[model samples]
Structure formats: structure tokens, C-alpha cells
Target: MRKVLLPTIIFIATILLVIRLFYLQVIDDTLKLKSDNNAIKINYDYPERGYIYDRNGNLLVANQPSYDIMVIPKDVKEIDTSEFCTLLKITKEDFLKKIAKAKVYSPRLPSVFLSQLNKKEYAAFQEIERKFAGFYIQKRSLRDYQVPCGANVFGFITQVNDKIISKNKYYNSGDLIGRQGVEESYEEILRGIKGVKYIQKDKYNREIGSYKEGRFDTIAVQGKDINLTLDAELQKYGEELMINKRGGIVAIEPKTGEILALVTAPSYDPAILVGRQRSKNYTMLYHDSIAKPLYDRGLLAQYPPGSPFKILTGLVALQVKAIDENTSIICNHGFSFAPGRFMRCHCHGGVIQLHRGIYESCNTFFSTSYMRTLDKFSDPSVGVDVWSKHLKTFGLGEFMGYDLPTGRKGNIPTSKTYNKVYKGWRWSSKTIVSNAIGQGEVLMTPMQLANMMATVANRGFYFTPHIVRKIKGQIIDKKFTTKHKTTINRRYFETMISGLFDVYNFGTAHGLNVDGIDICGKTGTAENFTKVDGKRVQLKDHSIFVAFAPKDNPKIAIAILVENGGFGATIAGPIASLMIEKYIKHKITRKDLETRILAKDLQPEYNRFISKPIRDTLINTKVTIKEKAVVTIKDTSGIKKRTALKP
Candidate 1:
């Protein structure tokens, strides 16, 4: 019985020993496999970014190969720390701090020490690359800007923030993303699908072969090309024309609503945001107080239309049946409601026809007409509300749904808004007489104003303004092709257009008329400024002009604003006229006009150009501190106080 019990105990012990061996070798195999992976895995692959292009098959943005020096705390080998720090031009303290941070970020994963290294830098490192184990270079792509000045339109790509990553699971840390404009709005379309390549690594962190013989690898697909309606020459010309000006110009085709040219003065070259020197250059340009070049004034600036508002009021009157084509309104220089006070007109004709009223921009005619339209309704506010609604349909006080991201919803006071502001139960035309002349609370973007002129040119209907004519190999959205209908009758626009034609022939915009090409236009000098103290400071007026050319079949319609440019007829009108002539004739015949416009020096407020001297002056002012404290600087006698440091 004793011999049998002893044998049973020994058998149980043998079974326990075998179970322990199985647990250690098989059950814990995952941990061993992970440990093996860490030993051989060194390099990481960076997915390529998408490409961008213009409507005419021109490459706008593309990717160029870049390299980043990275460090993996766990995988680093024995090396001369001093020599490595000197080669990288980094301080020993900075190197240690980076390594410590990298450990916290998972010692297996690499962290970037220097990003977007140039060819020279990469070549320097390539000479001694194999010596470093964990501190290897990772290949990537950086965005290259071609047509460099359209920063606001094309926007920029920046590192994805924590907020961005949290918002979208697709984005990872260190990923570049579109920050503004078309880049932001069409991110999905522009950002193509990323591809992955599986690589097999041997021990000691050396790549052995492609995993699965490249079966699991994916070839990177290129991004779709975007086609814009922008005419490169026209846009550049407009920008040059507005060099010293403080406003914007928006030109659009009346038939297609495709923007031909868009310009906002004080714009930065998009090229400044590309490559390794991007952050430094951006900081310098961004903080520039004078130019304020980064601001996108084209779609974002909201200003009173001034006298251009009268054109819409004329259409509104005609739409409401309160005025006819030959309807005459007597103007004794102004419209007077009370005993003495009157809303003044700027030197217009007397007893003018509806067409002549528009041609001469007869303020009294519109004021009386707008008042009559309001008189038709029981509540005066209802009539004004109706007028506001019609204006909204014209793309005023609302977004124009452009291809570019940035846009301001210009203010169009609603009945409810008026009720809240005025605290009144009722309102009348007299209460809102300023709107007749495109003043008071009425405001609109240059693009919106351009579309309004396009609508007038189309005779009561126009296409919605858009920047993209067509994306390469892709169809334009139906919304852009659809026409926007206004309240004004088709017949009314004919007479109004005829009067506008007469304006270029015989009225305010006469100075800018081309003999063969018929141009219809309205000039507006908006009075805006305030006195803070006893001294009467001269606050320059905004020069505004809206026009369409070759009246029979209007090809191009545009709105121009020269902020603080005093007279619209002299400043903004001539610019629009010149653009029309250039677009239609394919050249500017009026050399005299060009010379005068270019040479004419406007006010200080209007002048915001980044002259070469100013740019150089700003760049020279920047102080560069050497990264290495050991590097010595020499100040040579007879040499300008420039400090020369070791590279």
C-alpha cells in the first residue's frame, strides 16, 4: 500500500512540472514575440501627401522629399555624445531633454529631433548614417508652393493639433492638414488615401526584406487636381494695380458666375509658408504691423455700398410697381422730408427718367421711389422688410457660397433687427433713407457686390459666384451652375442697363470710358470716419465702383473698392475700366490711363504695399542667436557690425 501511494505522488509532481514548462514557453509567447519585434524594428515610413492643381492643368501644389532626424531612446547605441551633438548643432542639454521626452512617448517609437532637413544636411548625415543605430533619418514629403501669392485662396498645411486629432480619428500626431481656405473646405477631396508598406526587420534593427513579398504593400494614390476659375494674369494684374490701395476687387463672369480675378491688397506670398524655414519666416511676416498682409479682404471685408445701393433701390421700386421705365422724379439737388433738412445728392440732373436717374445716380429719385414703395403697405416696416428680403436674394447680407473658405456675411438689417435696435413698433422709408444711397446699416462683400452687378448685367438673374470652374477630371457641383433670381423684372434691367451704359457715355464714370467697348458703371464715395477729440481729422472716404462691359452681351462684371481713396469716379472707376479693357481687348490700349493710375500716390492709409526696402528692412531687423554656446563670433574692424558665427 505504501509503495503505490509514493508512486502516485511522484506521477502528480511530474504532471505539474510539465504544465509549468508549457505555461512559460507557450502561454507567454506573445511577450517574447513583442520583445523580438523591438530588437529589429528601427525605421518608420511616412505616407506621401496629395497634390493640387489649377483648372487649366497647372500644378499649384506638390510634394518634395524631406528627411527628419529621429531618436528612439530604447534603441540608441554607444556613440560619442559630444561629436553627435556638434554634428546636429544641438546643445548637450537639449539632446538629453529630447531623449527623456522620447522615452515618455514610448521608447520603441521614434521622436523627431530635426524636421525637414535640406539636401545638404541629409548628404552630410548620409556620410556617417550607418554608425548611428536609433538616430536614423526618416524620409517624408513637404508641400511645395508654385504660384506663391494666393495664400488666402490656397491656404496652408500645418501640423495636426490635439483638437484636430480628437475630432477626426483618421488624423494622427505630426500629420499635416489644411488650415484655411480651399485646403480646409475640400480637405477630404484634396487629402488622398494614405498607403502602407510592411517591412521585415532582423535583430540589431536592420531591414531584411519586404513583408509578404510586397503583397501587403499599397501604392500611394495621387490626390485629385482642383481647377479654379482664377485667371493667373488677371489676378496678378489686379494685385499689382491695388499695390498701395486698401480694398479688394472681385471679378466674375455673368453667364457662368466663375470668378475670373480676385485681389485683396497687402497679401503675402504663399511660398513663405513652405519648407524648413517656414516657421521663422511666418513669424516675421505675421507680426508685420504695416502690411497686415495675411488678412483676406476679398471675401471677408464688409463695407457700405454707398451710392451703388441706389441702383438696387431703383430695381426695387420697379419691382414693386411704384416706378416705371419713363417715370420722372424731380431732383432739386436733394430729397427733403422736413422744413429744412434734406438727404443730399452729389451733383445729379433734375427731373430725370428712370434710366437717367440710374445713369446720373439721382439720389432724390431713389429716395422718393423707395418711400413710395413703402407707402403701398399698411405697415411701413413690412414694405422695408420686403425690400430687405429682395436684397438678400441678390446675394447681399449673406454668404455667396464661394469655393474659398473665408467669407463675411455682410449685414442686411432685417425687420426684426430694426425692431430690436430702434425699439419701435413701426418704421418708414424716411427712417431708412440712407439705404437709398447704399449707406447706413447696409453692408456687403466685394464678391457679393460683383455678383449684384452681374445680376444687373444678366437683367434680373445671375449665377452664384464661385472660384472653381472645374476640378480636374471631376464635375462641378450643381449648386454653382444654378442661377440666382432677383425680385426685379427682366424688362426693368434693360432700361436700368441702358441708363448705366449712358453713365459711362455721359456721366460720372465718363473719364474711364473706352470708345469701342460699351461700359456701364456706378461710382460711390462712401463717407465713413469719426472724430474722437476736438481736432477735425481728415478721414479719407472709400472709393467704390461696380461695372459690366460690352453692354449687349456682358462678359465680365466687377466690383472695385479702394479704401480711403476719396473719389470713386477717379480712383476705383478707372481701375475697373482698365480691367474691363484688358480682359476684352486682351491688352490695355490706354497707356496714359495705366501710367496715371500706377504713378498716382494715394494717402498713407491707402498705401500698404510691401516694398523691397520694407521687406529687407524687416528681415534685417531679426536677431538670430546661435544654437551652440561654444560657437565663437568675430566682429571684424571696418566690417559693418554684423556678427559672423560658426555654421
Candidate 2:
């Protein structure tokens, strides 16, 4: 029985091996063609990248014809090197380096010799193409920006680096990929599949005809067109308003959570990164470290939210039942949490209810409410955590999961966050009452604040803010469509919304409103400080504002921050009102506001902080240095990181 079993096993193994060999030889030719690399010349058909359209179907990005000189390093027959170098506008040394690098990449496969050539250059090179053996011009499609703004929104495409090539077998040395913003986040949907074709080559290393009668070839699929939520006209207007400013503006559709416009000041035109000058222009933009034109302040910059944060504080207080709409507190021009110490306020002293507290930006009302909230619980730790839990539900203290790639989840302090800072020191609501007025450890990006406004506009629930409105022939991510409800009751928002509406009527932002629009808004001024020559100096306040229009049925919700722009009503409020008007009415009725804002440039204000020359301040503070000096002082602009101190 053992001898029979062994013989049967051997017989089965032989039969399986014979079937596999037959299938490999007769049926599948894909692996066979790939193995025969020496006889086949492979070419990739790069598809046209997807077109980007605004939500209203306006074209934001389209394709333009361009060319790249591709090289197969081993197939070269030397020609007039000097003439080739002159036509390509590259030095002889650069030619040698490029050829050597191409050879290092692969002698048989194609590599990019010179990329992003314009039509004139392509035509001139094509005239003398027959003279060079290994090089050929490959026709390509490059990004053509239809508008002048949104450089950060539709990020530029560039060649893949070595790291990408090593990880992705689908890409070769010369392939292009998206690097930031919507382009990076939706790369798979925007960059369609590149087709492959294998042609039989002769002994001379010249392509003859299709291998295997083109059975293994695949057709290039043009990238799927996408509709971004941005309104092109609104985006352009926002950029114009922010021309000489140093901050950002973010607006979202309250009902859908679609990002309408995201503007970061000191940005460059997207077209500059399209042709032969891309590398040079990009280097210039990247090196301008002070202005950071390439930096998307709307998505990346995190700053203490200032008075606008009080809106959330009011909501959290209501949810915790620490205060009601009718609850009133008397203000003596400030909040006195401890003896001989107080946090100052700019509001007129009087009896302040929740409505007047928000409109006047009162510090006393919120501080007392915050302390009462913590005292409600047996331990302040449990109380603060509950407060933090409510704020997190509003998309604060975390990334909002927006479609754009670059961002920071602004810090939201929990009890543990303070515990780590205090190191077991005794603490309570009075210890951190500055948080009540939004001047403490509460940091948020412009995007998050905009989302918070959108949440309020929606009454209780909000969809995750997203840049993509639609993708051609495919559904967008499900997460964007899902609703996220807050921990607070829906009815509580009406109480808060009424207070914000009066902010435009009788409060800090009373003078900054558009006629014929019922705008509910909050004005903010976040305290800003920086170090200059080893001394911490207070800079002008950062102006901030958050608002939604038509109060009852909202459309656009916006947040704007103007760094070092002083009070919120001066800069951020006007910009937000103008934006709301532009989006809703489609034209400007307040030419006075438009003219005044357009005429104002905050560059000189920014220059005062960042443009000072280095010198020994101990001797002559304003003198520029021309000679060697002892104890050279450097003026730097940055926040000194620390927990918010109690008054």
C-alpha cells in the first residue's frame, strides 16, 4: 500500500508540471514578451492630464501642447555637438552631464534629455532631428492655467525624483507627478493610466513593427476631468484683496461643505511653473523665505484664534448648561479672576447677557461662565475634558479632513495637555480662564475656523470641508458626503446665531457690513508677539473674522486672518464682508469699501518687523552693519512657544 501511494503521488506531480508548461508556452505571451527586452523597444503613451473646472463649470485648468527631448543613451551616433548644444540652449558641460545621467539611468530605456520645451523650441529641434541618432522629441501635454490665481489650489506638476521611481515600477525617470494641494490629494484621479506599447526591433536597435501583433498593448486613458468647489471669480477677487497682505482667507459652502475660495497672500502666478523657466522661478519663490509665496497660509498657518474663539466658548457653555441666553454678568471693563490681577476687555462696561457678551466681545461673561462650568463637576479635569469634547465635535483641535494636502491639526487642549504642562501642579478653571476669551492655548488654522462657521450656519451638522465637487464618471469619497453632528443641541445654535447677527448691527463689527445682507459674524483680534534682537516685542494684533450670510438660509461661510493688521474690524471684517457680497450679489455695491481696501497695502507694516538690517543693537539700534562687530544682534520674527498665562 505504501509503494502504491508513492507511485500515485509522483504520477500526479508529473501531470501537473506538464499542464503548467503547456499553458505557459502556448497561452500567455505577456511574461514572454517582457523577458525578450533586447528585441523589443517599449514606448509609453502619456495621457492628457485631467481638466480642472470650477463648481460653476468654468475652466480653471486645461492642457497646452509641449515637447520633451527623449534619449536612449546607447543608441547614439555622434553628430555636431556644438550645433546640438546651441539649438537646445544648453551649455556643452550641461549636455555631457545630462547624457551621462541618462546612461546611468539606463542605456536601453528612454530618459528625459530636455523637458517642457515650447513650440518654437520644438520646431527648431525637429528641423535638425535627423542629425541626432539617439534623441527624439516626444509630444506632450502640460498644464495651462486659465486663471491668474489659485496657484496653491491646483499645484504644478514636475518630474518624478529617484525616490518615487524606486518605489513605483509604473513610473520611469521622466514621469510627472503632482506635489501639493488638490493636485497631490487627487493624484490617482487626475493622472490617468499611461499606456504601454512594445515594438519589435531589428539588429540596428531601430523599431520595426508591433510585437505579437499588438495583442499585449494597452490604450492610454485620458485623465478624468474634475470639478473643484472653488468659484473662480470669487478666488480671483480674494487674491486681489490680499495683494500686499500677509495672511489667508477661506470660505466654504455651509450646506455642502464645499470650499469656495482659499487665498494665501504673496502668491505667484501658476503659469510661471509651466515651461523651461519653471526651475528658476520655483527656486526664486522657494528662497523668498520671509514672504513664503509658495506657502499656503490658508491651510498651513496655525495661530491663536483670538476673539472669534469666544463663539465656540459660548456654545460649549450652553451645551454644558453653565449659562443660558438670559444669564447676565456685570462687567467692570475686564474680568477679575484673582485679587489685583485681571484680563482687560475693550467692551463697554454694563450688564452683559449672552447676546451682548458675544456682540461686544466681552471677556467677563465668558470667563465667569467657564469657571462655573468646571466647578459644576467634582474635578476640573473631568470638566475641561467635557469642554474639549464639545469643541472637537465642531472640528476644532484636529484636522478637518479636507481634500487639500497640506495642513496642521491646530492644538486643542485636554486635561492631559495641561497635566503635562503643569506636571501635577494644582490647577482649576481659574488657572486657565484666559481660554474663555480665546486667548490661551487654543490654536486653529484659517480652514478650521471657516469650518466652524459653516457648522454654525448649518445649525448643528456639517459635512467635512472638501475642494472636490465632482469627479468625471466616478463618485467622490463617501466621507465627504457623511454628516458630522455636534454634541450640542440644534436649538442652541439659534441662540448663538442671533448674537452673532447683532455683531454686525451694534457690536465690534457694526460698521463693516454689506447692505441688503443679513450677515451673522464675529470679530477677532489675536495678540501677536515676536522676538527681535533677543527681546520679546509685541507686534500689531492679528485681525480675524468669521461670518455667514442671510442668517436664516446661509450660503457662504468665511474666515479671514490678516497678520499684524491690528483690530479685526479694520481689516479682516471688511475683507470678509466684501467677499460675502461678491459671492452673493456677484458685484460690488460698496465701491467705497472696495476702493479703500484696494488702496491699502500692509507691506510697510510687515517690513517694519521683517526687513530690519542686522546690527549690534547695544550700540546703535537702527544702524546697518558694514564692518565686523562684537555681539552681533539678529532680529527674528517668531512666536515664543508657551502655555497661555493666567491674569
Candidate 3:
């Protein structure tokens, strides 16, 4: 019986082992595929990135062929290193370093050794690539800009860093990623899936045929193309008008909340960030601390919203029942808070109500109204918080959640904010009355100001402003479609709108109005000051203007800011008026205004504000002229890097 039991146990064990072998060989192929890796060479096929078109179907960005030289460290064979370096126009030290980096990344996987080779270089390399084992050419696409504008809107692509590679497993070494702007915001939708092919190789590492007849291979899916809401022609015109200026301009469609044109001065051509020259050109642009061309002032720079803020003050007062349309405040040329601490107004001494006060930009009137709104509550903190809530509903004092990658939470001083500054509830409505005139801790981005005007046009509601209108075969995110109602009731906006309309007809901006357009606008002149050698020094004022055209059913809402440009009417008003006319009329009838703007270069005014050493250095280096030439030529060849491949 013992002998029979031992034999039966052995038989059962043998049957179990046979079943396991059959299951592994037939059903589970994962281990088998790993074992077969030694005889299979994998190749990646990158798909063309999606194209970008303006709202009018004008192509803004398209793909151009680019080739990269990739290397597998484990497959490398000894060859003439000098000859290879000379062919690639790289030094032996660089070649060695790249090879070391590739080995560290992965001994068997491919890494980019030399990237962005031009057509001439590609032809030269193709003739001799067979001599270099372990290296192959991989095809990819780089952006080919159709226009020289919108550098801040259409950001560039760059190779992924170690941080990105670690965070996203989908990306490998030497992969390109969007850096900023629309490209960065929609990276996933723009960068298509990479297809992989497994080639069977012999024991000698020679390619023989496809592995398993390509059963495991994938087909690359092309990226979905996107249409931006921007008007390319208007954008170009705005950029042209803003030349030699330092500020930001944002235009939004009032009905849809689509950004029509976003222009930032001192911007470079988008092409400057493309190809192998990107790093060098980026360094040059980045080092220019004065201009800061990389900085998107439209979405990033926060400044005092100036008189455009007075409009909000009026609205908040009306919403809180602190003021009515017929409510009148007298201006003795200023509102005297204390014996010497008076908030001055440029409007001639007179009694004024809401509409005339707005058109005249009466500082006294707005300040008195602001005081009433804040003084309504016994505790100034409660009043300040209430006022802040009303302002935030207009998309001020916070990140507006626009589609851009960068923005500032412009300050809307709450009771809590002042508590930190004043250390208690020691402040009152009169103590912080400068806020009534858009001074004192209140700040806003140009985009936010434009959106505020859009909200006014929409009568207390706005869709989140976005650059993208649609993606081919896919709907845009629902956030852009949702309407955000402001804290003020819709009925209150009518009074504010009427006041704004009077700004064009009888206010400071009356002379700058377009002929056929019924424009509603506010002009602002913010007092500028800076520290020079640790002492406050007064500089030229910052000009600001915000407006919407065809007031009844507004089509375009825009905000323009010009640093050190004097009164709002001097520069920003004309620019805003021209921009509105360009978008609505599709042609500029004010050629005289256009010529004056084009002929004027405000570098001298900017120079006066800069420190002597930096100003002298800039002059000695001729950096401004070089930068201007860089924009005009759009030639990246002067940049020190491998030439990019052409399509």
C-alpha cells in the first residue's frame, strides 16, 4: 500500500507540472515576450502634432519635418569618433557626454544623441549612417509658424527634462513637451500617441523580419487640430501698434468670452523658440531683465486697474443700495479726507451724478460713493469684505481661470488683507479711501480688466475667457461654456452701462471714439512711483483704458495699458479705439492715429525710469536693436546650436 501511494503522488506531481507548462506557453505570453526581447528591436514612430488655426481658418501653426539622431548604448560599436563628431558638427567632448547620458538613461533603449538636423545635414548623414552602428534617424515634427506674431499666445516646445520623465511614465528621454501658452495648456490634445514596431532580429543582431507579423504593433494616432478664437489680422495689427511699447492688451468677444487678440509688448516671434537654436535664443531673451520678453504681461503683470476700477465701485454701491442713479456728489476739485490728505480730481468743480461722474472720471464722486458703500456697516471689516465680494464677482482680485498657463491673483483687499497690514480693526472706510480711485492695494491683470468689461457688456455675467474655440472631432471643456453670474443683479448693470457710454460721448475719451461705433470706455492715469537708491521716486504715469464697442449689443471688449505713457487718452485710448475699429470694421479709417502710434517710440520714457548702470549697459550692448532685428528677421541661424531639419 505504501509503494502504491508513493507512485500515485509522483504521477499527480508530473501531471501538475505538464499543465503549468501548457498554460504558460499557450495562454500567458508575457514572460515569453520578455524572453524574446533579445532578438527584437523596437522602433518608435512619432506622429505629426496637431495644427493650429485662427478663428477665421487662417493657419497659425503647422508641422515641419524634423529628424533626430538616436542611439542605443548597448548596441554601440567602436568606430572613428572624430569622423562622427565632424560629420555631426559637434565636439568629441559633447559626443562623449551625450553617450554617457544615454547610457545612464537606459543601456538598451534609444536616446537622442543629436537632434533637429536640417535637410542638408540629414542628406549628408543618410549617405554615411550605415557606417555608424547603434545609431538611427527618427523622424519628428517641429512647429512651423505661419506668422511672426502671437509669441505669447503660441508658446514653443522643448525636450522633456528629468523631472517630467520621472513624473509621467508615458514620456521617455529626449521627448518634446510644450513649454507655455496654448501649446502647454493643450499638450495632450496636441501631442499624438507614438506607434511602436517590433522587428525580429537574428542571433547576430541583424534585422530579419517583423515580429509575430506585427500583432503587437500599434498605429500612431494623429493629434487633433484646434481652432483658436483669436483674430490673426487683428492680432497682427495690435502687435504692430504696440511696437516699442511696454504693456499688455487683451480683447475679448463679449458674447462668447473668446479672446480675440492678446498682445504683449517686447514679444519675440514664435519661431525664435523652435528648432535647435531654442536654448540660446531663450537665454538671450530671458537675460534681458528690463524687457522680459518671456513674461506675458497680458496674463501675468498686475497693476492698479486705475479709473476702470471706478466703474466697479459705482456698480457695487448701486448693488448695495448705497447709491442710486440720481444720487449726486459735489466735487470741489477733490474729496478732502483730512486737512492735507485730500484725494484730488481733475474734473472741474461741480455737482455730478453717476453718468456725468463716470464720463468726467470724477475722483471725488467715486471716492464718496466708495465711502458710503464701506461705511454702510458698523464694522469696516464687514463692509470691506462685502465690497470685496462684489468686486470678485467681476473676476477681479483672483485668478480668472483663463486657459493660459500663467496668471496673477490680482489683489482685491479684503478685511483680512488689511488686518495683516494694519495689525487690527484699526482701519476704517476713510483710512483706506484711496481704494475708491483704484489705487491703494487694488490690482488687476489686463486680461481680468478685459473680462470685467466683458461682464459689463453681458450685463452681470461672463463665460470664462478661453483661447480655444473648438478641437476637431471633440468639444471644448464645459467650463468655458458655463456662465458665471456676478454678485450684482442684472438690473444694476444698466446704470453702469449708461455711465460708461457717456464716457465716449462726453468724457475724457470723447475725442478718441470711433466714427460709427458707439463705444463705452473708461480712461485711467495711475500715478507711478518706484524706489531709487531706497527712496521713493515719482516716474511718468501709466496710461490705461478699457472699452467695449457698439454698446447696446457689444461685440468686442478690450483693455489696454501703456507704462509711462502719460494720460490714458494720449496712448492707450487711441490704441483701444483703433483695435475696436479694426475688429468691427475690418479696416482702420484713422490712418493719422495709426501713423502717430507707429512713429512714436517710448524707449526714452522707459529709459528715464531704469537705473543709470542698467540703462548704460543696455545702450552699450545695443541689446534693444539686436532684439528688434531678431524679431524682424526671425532668423535663428545666428543662434548657436544644430540647425533644425526642414520638411
Best by TM-score: 2
> Which has the better TM-score: candidate 1, or candidate 3?
3
Query: lDDT for each of the candidates?
Result: 0.75, 0.86, 0.87
Cα lDDT tens digits for candidate 2, 1-647? 99899999999999999999988898988779878998998888999999999999999999998899999998887688999998888899999999999999999889999998889999999998999998998877889999878999999898999899999987898889988977899888888999989899999777889998998889999999999999999999998988778799999999999999999976768887888888866765665455677789999999999988888888888988999989989999998888888899899989999999999999898889888887889999999999999999998888888888889999889999889888859998998898887778888999999999999999988999999999999999999999999998988899999999999999999888888999999999999989998999999999999999989889999999999988999989999999999999999998888887887777566656543332112233321211111112334434321110000
RMSD versus native structure for model 1: 9.9
Writing each residue's lDDT as its tens digit, candidate 1 over 73-146 gives 77788977888888778899998888887787568766676777888889998789777767878777777877
Better of 2 and 3 by lDDT: 3
Worst 10 residues of 1 by lDDT: 625-634
Q: What residue pairs are clashing in model 2?
A: none
Ranking by TM-score: 2, 3, 1
As a TM-score, model 3 comes out at 0.92
lDDT of 2 at 389: 92
Residue pairs in candidate 1 whose N, alpha carbon or C atoms collide under 3 angstroms: 55-227, 148-270
Q: Which ten residues in a row have the lowest lDDT in candidate 2?
A: 623-632
